[model samples]
Target chain A: MEVVNRYVATRHHVEGAPTEADFEVREETLRWAPDSGEVLVRNLYVSIDPYQLNRMKRSSASHLAVDGVLPGQRITSYAAGEVVASACAEYAAGDVVAGVLGWEEYTLFKPSPGVLMSKVDAGGGFPLSHHMSVLGTSGMTAYAGLFEVCKPVKKGEKVFVSAASGSVGNLVGQFAKLAGCYVVGCAGTTAKVDLLTDKLGFDAAFNYKEEPDLKSALARHFPDGIDICFENVGGEMLEAALANMSVHGRVALSGAIAEYTGEGRRAVPDLLEMIYKRITVRGFFAWDFLPRFAEFGVVVGGWVRDGKVKVVEDVSHGLDSVPAAFAALFRGQNVGKKLVKLA
Target chain B: MEVVNRYVATRHHVEGAPTEADFEVREETLRWAPDSGEVLVRNLYVSIDPYQLNRMKRSSASHLAVDGVLPGQRITSYAAGEVVASACAEYAAGDVVAGVLGWEEYTLFKPSPGVLMSKVDAGGGFPLSHHMSVLGTSGMTAYAGLFEVCKPVKKGEKVFVSAASGSVGNLVGQFAKLAGCYVVGCAGTTAKVDLLTDKLGFDAAFNYKEEPDLKSALARHFPDGIDICFENVGGEMLEAALANMSVHGRVALSGAIAEYTGEGRRAVPDLLEMIYKRITVRGFFAWDFLPRFAEFGVVVGGWVRDGKVKVVEDVSHGLDSVPAAFAALFRGQNVGKKLVKLA
Candidate 1:
């Protein structure tokens, strides 16, 4: 059988802040048999994240994002899709699943054990987009980072979430609130900051762009000291947070969007501060914590039902908007989990 | 009642690498009796270390060495002393003790609850100087950094200890070796490197100063990547170690001697390396792990008896040499534990 698929591909290697002009839509004719445990999937939704920018760059020691998109290659993303054809016992044609699939209309792949792919259970009242956003990789990231990595006991302790209204940061703030912490967040836009406190139950929120001195901004919010920091934008932001961290503070590093386009020479002036404060600055990936995804769903799923947790989606219209939607993330145009819808 | 005691005092605020000129021997006349819960102790041995340098400098956020020595005040250090007089029943005259006291012949102090001061049994058949070296603050620091912080399972995993011949660094290397790890160490001098491999049972040793490219030197030693880093010298050594760190690597941050003498703007070029590898860079103080001192003494004390562990003292004579002894630590003049002897 012959099938035509349209996908977004990088025009060339990306530099600095990515723009819509850097990507072009390409067509591919996929022809394949369902080998042993193989299946053909129709793409439904795809998630855009900062780490993808690492893969689009030239090779270096800091090229951590393993699944890099090559020139003229379909961009790889965390996608939700429907299995159209399968030779696997695990999935049927109509079963909805989430995995690291292509940014295309169709994906031809095999599901081995322990692959990034997972079937999404639709028993929850929320929409499939919610599953792709809050209950998916992003949600799991916030949960694992807060519970497993930061391990904040709360007790009215300060919790600082950078990129406050973004995909993982929003969930982290809500969770911290539930855990009895004095939650605070810093985002790029005033609208995003307002959403953090006004809608997401954050105790305090500030626009980072409004305050050039982040260290002082953090200190004003966290007079006592930050017990935990869910860091998204690294470099100077991280340095400022480190200065305001209390003794034995834990920093769960999820992303470093600031240094992705640069040479990644992170100047942590007070890096030695960790020695005196007994700070734990640990970096983690959500995929590494996928083993507890089911556990996270049961816990966070209840929070969502009780109206304790909030979800936001900055979604694009069609496959054509994928490039612009992804580029919008770098420019801080998207307020939450940036996703593109496809058929 | 007019007995005069000579003590080392900071002449003025110290800047950069400490020198003998920064301190002066000042004489104090004793007059007051031991008040309620107070005692007069004759210090026998004063432990000189790098952390004291922080106290000699001006204050800032990074001045985390809380017990900073004021310009005119006698320097504070972990001391082995004899209780000459006591109003508190907990300590008797002639009682041999180890505690935070002045770098002087006598210290009039009260033992508060949870005080750093404690009585030394000296029942292990080792010299009292050992109580100031391997059995004192330095020993406790090494033990805590290696065990509680690093948590190495060994199984032939690689352990890298920087400043391998210094106070805590020697003990860390020896402990990692005992724990069945392939231990490697780097130091400034070839003699220190020789002492690490030949005397301390390190699997390999390199003079970091001799090797301009530390990353390459570390790569050669840790071909499989470092499992645990008993970090002492930070900056370039830390950067090199981070580059050579394996996935799930643990860095037990003990000190950053390089930053102590210079501006602490530690530029970790590729700090994002932690995210991809899931590395844990934690800073810890030995005081946090003081409760485990007896446990360390039992385990390491046994190692001492069995001749598995060794001690090296770079002792300075008289109270006047204390400044020089402390300055020697910055100069890398001392081979092992730097100490000042006063009788």
Candidate 2:
């Protein structure tokens, strides 16, 4: 059968800031074929993230591992899709699966060693988009950073999150609150600040743009000093967080979207504070916690079902909008999970 | 018996920089009385350190846990002394002990719980002053920061040290070399740079003063980037170190003399780099590694005896010069371990 696959493509090198010129939508023809170990999937939803921007950059370390896209190469992302055909014993036609699928209407998948693809429970109350979002990398990132890395969140322990209204930060704040810790966060705008404090149940939130001094702003909100910091924005926000961290505090480094674009490095605060205060700053990737994925899903899925955890999604329709949705993450346009719908 | 003892006292708070005005010598009358577990000792050598300056500050977190001097309380420090009188079973007359003793000719030690004192090995070949220098807190700080915290220093890894000619930095450089790692270090002066490269056997050494661009200097010296950094001088040095750190690098936070007494905090490079690079930054105190002191002593003592590890001493004679000797650390004076001899 002939398949008309619409996919987002990286058209050219991104200069100062990414614009529409950097990405394009193109039509592709695909033959519906499933080899012995392959499956054909009709795309459902795709995850859009700030990390994808780093992937687009020429000098990024992430790009070093994977070949940089030439003009008209299909943009790749974590996507959830329904299997239309399968010769693989693990899956059959009409089976729902989630893995790294490109921004396309139809994708051909061949089982390679170590490639992750799992069947989704369609009976679950959550939408299929949730598979690529709250139950996906974003949710896992928040879980690993907050619960695993920044462990033993005691009551009244103060926690701070930068990019607090974004996909990962939103869940991190809620998780901290659920653990009975006092959570404070920083976002770019007052609307995000309000959303963090009011909607996300954060103890305090600030618009970093409005705050003249970030260190003073943190001191004002957390008089006792922060016990844990979930760092997202790297440069100035990370410095402020480190400055305001209390004795024996922990900083869980998840992302630094600010510095991913090869900008000249910013100044770091006196790390001697880390020595005097006995801080433990550790960097972790969510994929490292793959062994705990099933365990994490059980806990977070239950929280969502019980309304103890809220899943926020900023979803755009059509595979053509994948580039815009991914770019929106860097611009802070998305309040929570940024996703693109293919069907 | 009447005993007249000379003790160093803080005359007045030093403004801007420390000087002889920061201290004064005074004679105090002592009663020849010994309680059940108390001992009267004559101090022979005292440790003058960069951390002492932090204690001199009015309200620093590094200040003494007990009430700080009222400008007249005798300056306190860790000292190696010979016991003249004792009522404790563990210590007696003529016994050599190392503990927190005042910077004075004589001190009364009331042996409380957890107060440690052991007879010095006269056959150890090294001078008793070695206990106050390499075999004491300074040496232990290096051992702990290198082996304990920045562990698994595999052969062929690159190690970077700031303040490479200082007490702790000097030892760390030697230890990293012995571990078969390519060690590079930065010092303040050309003389220290010579000491690091020529005497201490660092693979690469640079005078940070001459190189205004620390990042470029580091990139030039360590093209592969540093696997471990024994951070002593914090601020811009730390920023440079972070910018040049390899993936999975470990930073052992030891001291930050650069910003110990300052109006503003030091600028740190992007900490998010830690996240992307998956670096591990840990702050540690030497006291925490006291349990492994004997094990460390055996290895280091053997290295020293074989002449594989060289110990450099910047000894300043006379108790009266204690203040000046300590102030030298902040100014990056005295290659190797800085000590004050008072007999």
Candidate 3:
């Protein structure tokens, strides 16, 4: 049988601003074989995250310890795929699995140590794409950052979220609403502001682009000051949030999409505000909470199914559009979880 | 008996830059009689701290339930004094007591419930002024921030300290050194830099003011990145520190002298850096460690006596120099613990 394996690859190193020229398409020859503890997967969906931009950079100093894709190596990420071939007793040929799969037509799934890929029930109510977004790392990130670090959200506490329309922020706002907190969020445009207040149930929302003065906008939105700040955009937004944070406030350092492109570095914030307010700013990695994934999946999946937690995904069709789709996250182009469907 | 009290008071609010006009010399009438559970004390020494300047501001939102100092009230602080008249049986007429005493020649010591004051040792090797600086709040601040929050410092771990020659930073460096960590520090000037490397035994020291690029300087000093950061100066220093911090590094947010004054605020740092680095930035108040003081006192006091922990006090003679002395901390003009002598 002739196997036509199509794969997306990076073209060149991305400097200051990433362009379409940064990525390229490549076709690779495929061999269909299964060794012990291996199951071949037919890639269906791939997650495109802002953090992937860091991996595209040539410098290893800034990038996380993931093996970066070279000019011709197939790009890979957390993807949901169907097991087309299998040698491992754990999987059957037609089983649906979720794991690190390549951004290609088909992938050879080797059973690496410490890898977690499980079969999903075909009868589940949620869509398969939900595994790559809300029921995936994005939701886990919001859950870990909010509940684990900034614990015990008391009723009537003011919560401020930056990048409020993004995948994580949208769910964080919904979770805060469930916690009975007065949620206020900031986004880049009026549409995002509307999404936060109207759809996500945020009590107040502001377009950071429209407001020249971020500190004043925060103060106006939260007169009593923010009790918890789900920080995603770093730069000026973090500064304004710190200035307006109340005593004993918690700032969950989830992401900083603004400075990911290595632009003119934003001004450093006043650290004295943290001390004066007794603020707790903690950084968390979702992978660290993998042990709790089953628990998280049960809880978050139920929330999504019950409509208590809303899941928003900005899906781009075709695997060839993955680079632009990932880059869009930094530009605030994606409203929710940005993903690429490789059907 | 003719009783007279000489006190220091704030004459007016400090403007853009504090001047001698901000304070005035005044002599107030004193009563010789002591009410029930009250003691009359002869003021010996008083602490001059950066937080006092915050109290001098027209508006302040301190977490410690402190109100701003009104126009005419006497400046109060943790001071050491000799009891002259006593109505409490626990204290005698000649007992040397230390508590919150005003910047005056004589102070009325009312027995505040739940307040504990140390009985000064007449034959102690350390100077009495050490109570306000090293042996008091400043020392406690360092001990708490370093040992309590940044715990389990494994041998050969890298530790970085900002404002390394200052009161708390000096002690923090020594404690880290004792724990067998490679300690690096940054100070404002060459002299302070020299003090960090030579006097404090820091593995490396740099003048942050002389280094135009803080991130590059940090990379050069801590090539592998810092494991713990004792943050005293905030703003750009904090940003650079965060960038150079190693995975799972703990940033002990003790003080941020960089933003103490009304100077233009620095840019906010990219919060994503914390997530990528998996850092923990915790703000700590010294009073939170009150329960551990007795245990800490025994350990730190022994260290002081054994010459393992060196204490530095920047003493400004006379209470009249208190405001000017405190202003020096914000300007990075003082090398160590800034204090005022009343006797």
Candidate 4:
């Protein structure tokens, strides 16, 4: 049978702060019959990530910057969906799965054996979109990036998070607080700052836009020194964190959305200080910790059920609004898990 | 009775590159009588280190850069000496001791209990000056920085060392070579590069000053990827190393003499690359590994004895030449360990 699929695709290549005009929504028809070892899924929700902006650009560096989605092609992202038809023994009709899928209402995925298609267990009692939010890749990023990479955030250590209102940063702050750490976060707007402190339970929050000097701003908040820095916004913010870090501090280079457009200025650190202070700075990708997802789910799901993790979503409705919501991410307008619902 | 004492003192504060005139040789008389729990030593040698320039600076940063020697006070340095008088019963005349002492010929050390003064066990069959060179702080630095900080240099992995002709770098390259790694190093001069490959047993050596593009120079040498970088001369060399580092690569930042003067332009690294490549860039002080000094002494001592480790020292005679020899360190003119010999 043939089905009409509505999806959003990039209209043209974008540079520097992607706008809604960079995308065009259209309808397409696809004949759906699952091939061998394949499945047909109706995507319930699609994730809008900072990394998507990188995929739309051309570069030859050894960066995680994937090839950009070209004109007339539907973009790819981590998505949560319900399987409509299946040829693979691993999946059946109506099974909920979260993995790589296109930004379309329906997808026919001939996934390689044991890659990108995992049938998520459904007893969590949360909405399916939460799979794309806290229970999915973003949550794994916060879990692995915090516990595995940045030395697990010692109790009573001062922790600092840049872009603390974003999907990954918010969870990092919560996880750190759970570890009994003194947590401070920085955001771009006052409302986001309030969300971090009032709603999110950060020990302190500051609006980076209001602070004229980031170094002093970090110093003012982190008087004892930052024991762990969950670095998301790169450039000047990262440098300020480096300068204010305590002896034997650890910095997890989680993301650099500030320079995803390749147009932002980066901070230069005094490499000498790295030795004198004996700091360990490491950068990692979330997939490195995929094997531990089952291990992560057990702990994080309990937190969610116990109401320890306050889940937030800045989701928009319909396929037509995907571009606008995605654009809002770079503008720092999203409160939490930025997604698009297309049920 | 008073003994005439000669020492070197900073004439004035040095801002950038230290010149010969920034220091002066002066004479003083010390009425030395070992009081209760006090010991006196006749200085034999004084080590000239890059960190001394930091001491000459006027700042209160938590760097190795300490308060510069005031205009009139004799400089403080790590020294090896012969005990001339003792009231502490821990030492007697002719016993050799090495620790942080004065640059003056005689130092009356009322050592607080068990700190700062320790007798050296002789019979290593090396000269007394060797205590200030391969057997002293410099050797410990190379050993600890390589073994402890840079992931212990696995066999056959490609290792690169910057400032490969200097006191610490030379030893690091040798240690990596002994561990059966493909070691490459960068030096400022052709003579130093040749010394690294020929005398120090490096696999390949490049003159960074001769190369127009350090990144390409490193890429040519590291066609596969660099697993470890023993960074000493920071700035552009460090950046090039960072660009070429492989996944999970560990960079041990031992020193940054390039910026010791607080004036040299250092090449700032792209903090984002640390994440993309999963690199661990750490800076550490050699003293952090002091507990392992005995373990280090056993291995490095054997290397020096069996002609496995080549010991080199550039020494100037008399206290009058101390300022000139010490100033030459910033100029990158010294080979191996630089020291001043005082009788």
> What lDDT score goes with residue B135 in model 2?
84
Worst 10 residues of 2 chain B by lDDT: B61-70
Among all candidates shown, the one with the greatest DockQ: 1
| Predicted candidate 1 versus true structure: per-residue lDDT over B1-343, tens digit per residue | 3358788899988878888898999988865465656788889888888888877877743466476668978877788889888889899989998888878988877779756888888678888888888878888888898889889875798999999999999998898888888999888898898888888899999987789788999999888899999999888788889989988899988889988888534647465688888888889888898779889878877888889999988888889898888888887888889888889
* Model 4 docking category: medium
**Given candidate 3, what's the lDDT at residue B40?**
81
Residue A265 CA error for candidate 1 (Å)?
7.6
Against the true structure, whose TM-score is highest? 1
* TM-scores for every candidate against the unseen true structure: 0.97, 0.87, 0.88, 0.94
Error of 1 at A317 (Å): 1.9
Clashing pairs in 4: A55-A68, A275-B283, A283-B275, B55-B66, B55-B67, B55-B68, B56-B68
Relative to the unseen true structure, what is the C-alpha lDDT of residue B198 in candidate 2, on a scale of 0 to 100?
87
**The candidate that achieves the highest lDDT relative to the unseen native structure:** 1
Q: Which stretches of candidate 4 lie over 4 Å from their true place?
A: A1-7, A26-35, A60-72, A111-114, A152-154, B31-33, B60-68, B112-117
Using DockQ as the yardstick, the better of models 1 and 2 is 1
* Candidate 3 Cα deviation (angstroms), residue B33: 4.6
Residue B197 deviation, candidate 3, in Å? 4.8
Q: Give the CA lDDT, 0 to 100, for residue B21 in model 3.
A: 70
| Model 4 CA lDDT for position B214 | 90
Residues A10-119 of candidate 2: C-alpha lDDT, one tens digit per residue: 88765334666688889988776555467888999888777766666655555533455556777667889988888788888999888878778888878776677778
Using Cα atoms, each model's DockQ against the true complex is: 0.64, 0.46, 0.47, 0.56
